[model samples]
Target: MRVDKYLKNSRLIKRRTMAKKACEQGRVIINEKIAKPGDEVKPGDIIEIKLGTGSTKVEVLSIKDNVAKNQSEELYKHLKGF
Candidate 1:
């Protein structure tokens, strides 16, 4: 999945556009390197997101086109949270 879509589908960010902006601003990293919005993300990849105050790290577990709000958290595992 694309990083931006993954972020939104997983509910990491509130919207796809916001996730894209975050990537453009270098606030999103994949496997420790800065990633573009269209970067491909897969299972076991590590993703870090920089928020206003702090950052969060997550490990991708699975990829799905759509998920319910209650099931979104299952898409990735939270490694660390700020």
Candidate 2:
């Protein structure tokens, strides 16, 4: 899945646009490399997001086009974050 979509579907970010902006600004990283909004993400990939003064890290667990709010957390495993 696309990183922006994954972020939104996983509920890591509130919106896809915000995720895209974050990526454009170099706030998103995957596997230790900077990530673009259209970057492909898969299971087992490590994702790090630096937003404002905080940082969040997660391991991709699964990918889906659509996910329920209650089940969003199942898409990724939180490695570290605020």
Candidate 3:
């Protein structure tokens, strides 16, 4: 799935547009490399999102086109964050 979509579907960023903007500004990283909004994300991939002085890291656990708000956390495993 696209990184932006994954972020939104996973409820990490709350919105696809915000995720895209974050990617454009180089705030998103996957597997230690910078990620573009269209970057592909798969299970086991590491994703890090840096915002201001804090950041969040997660390991992709699954991908889906749509996810329930209550179940979004199942899409990724939190590795580290504020």
* Cα lDDT tens digits for candidate 1, 1-82: 8999999999999999999999999999999999999999999999999989999999999999979999999999999986
Q: Each candidate's lDDT (Cα)?
A: 0.97, 0.96, 0.96
TM-scores for all candidates: the values are 0.98, 0.98, 0.97
For candidate 2, write residues 1-82 as lDDT tens digits. 8999999999999999999999999999999999999999999999999998999999999999979999999999989997
Model 1 TM: 0.98
Q: Which stretches of candidate 3 lie over 4 Å from their true place?
A: none
lDDT (Cα, 0-100) at 3 in candidate 3: 98
Per-candidate Cα RMSD to the true structure, in Å, reads 0.6, 0.5, 0.6
lDDT per residue as tens, model 3, 1-82? 8999999999999889999999999999999999999999999999999988999999999999978899999999999997
Runs of candidate 1 with Cα error greater than 4 angstroms are: none
The top-ranked prediction according to lDDT is 1
Error of 1 at 32 (Å): 0.7
Model 2: weakest 10-residue lDDT segment is 73-82
- Cα lDDT of candidate 3 equals 0.96
